[model samples]
Target: MVVTRSETQTGAQTGAVQNSSEGWKQQPPYRTTEGDEGFEKKWTAHCHCGRVRYWLSRDGPLASKFCHCVDCQALHGAPFQWAAIFHKEDLRFESGAEGLAFYHAPDKSTTHRLPCKVSCAYCHAPIMDEGRNMVLMFPGIIKFSDAEHKKLFDPQCHIFYSQRVVDIHDGKPKWSKLDGKSELMKEVEREGSNTILGEPKNENMQD
Candidate 1:
């Protein structure tokens, strides 16, 4: 899915809102590298206060990207949001969901939805975004062993680049809106500097 603002604002009610992560017990436990023959690589992530923790089963994320949408900028209080995509089943909570809190966009009362922003209740640190079939995890919270392991979450492209507050010079593709659904914007060369294809070069100049 595209994981747009509208989708996060009003996701279909799947069932009763889960109050705890007790249901996560049904999932298999993470494997260790000690003597287990079937030891699978896993990545552990925690909130600011360490009250909320989770594990990713896969070695790497299914997809990773930098989102420049206004919604993300406002919610994160940053220029962009870097997110790693993973199947809903790939994530598992450590202890329970007691320390986790959810924020439903548009309407906070609607909690029985698929798309919602998960955060640490105490520290108020944004964790991951839960979607219907996938979850957008924040790479910052993950504990990577080294620089190489961290590269697994590197963004492949910039989405919603048209809404970006700052221009990026990276050679990675920049999409006007959605990744594959929108236009692949060309990098315009102005005064020996590259800028967005259709944007005015002058900062204070009106379009």
Candidate 2:
């Protein structure tokens, strides 16, 4: 039930695209908590103002998806949210840890307080969404070329499609909610009465 800081701040546009604290490297390639200080090559994430920097040893996200839920819409200011999930241990902030801010909220259907929204105090850009075991990283933060963006930012499915502010016709599977265990979607969901094939379902930009 957790989401990335950038997603919530922008309006939870699962269709597109946190933290603060300490001990981060002040250099360009930041290092994360243990796991394989053993491994080298990492992916660095930073705030809009270049005030914060973090890195991921994982070459890519463990999972990727587009979210179309009300929470996402209320946060990311976009039609849908594009997210990539990674283990918390894989993310690291090189600097600006002390300048981080957190927005704590109870997750859906749960009463426990969780730091779901994290942002940089200076630039206020989303860093990551922390879950119990993993973090939802935003691909939009990555400074990628058009080719890398296309190849590295592939979403596998759409979650919470029923609350969609707009429709996507990418042919990816759409589920009503967290169907992570049931089955992964193979084709796009085309159930809305007002939906038209091959066109976006009037994307909402207002958060």
lDDT tens digits, residues 54-144, model 2? 7776777877988876666666677777888876666676543456665544433211123356667788887766554566788888766
Best by TM-score, which number?
1
Model 1, 109-195: lDDT tens digits are 534234678788899898887766677899999999999999989999988777776777777888777777667776544357654
Model 1 scores what on Cα lDDT? 0.70
Judged by whole-model lDDT over C-alpha atoms, candidate 2 comes out at 0.58
RMSD values, in order shown: 6.2, 9.2
* lDDT (Cα, 0-100) at 204 in candidate 2: 21
Worst ten in a row by lDDT for model 2: 15-24
Off by over 4 Å in 1: 1-4, 8-41, 110-112, 188-207
TM accuracy, model 1: 0.75
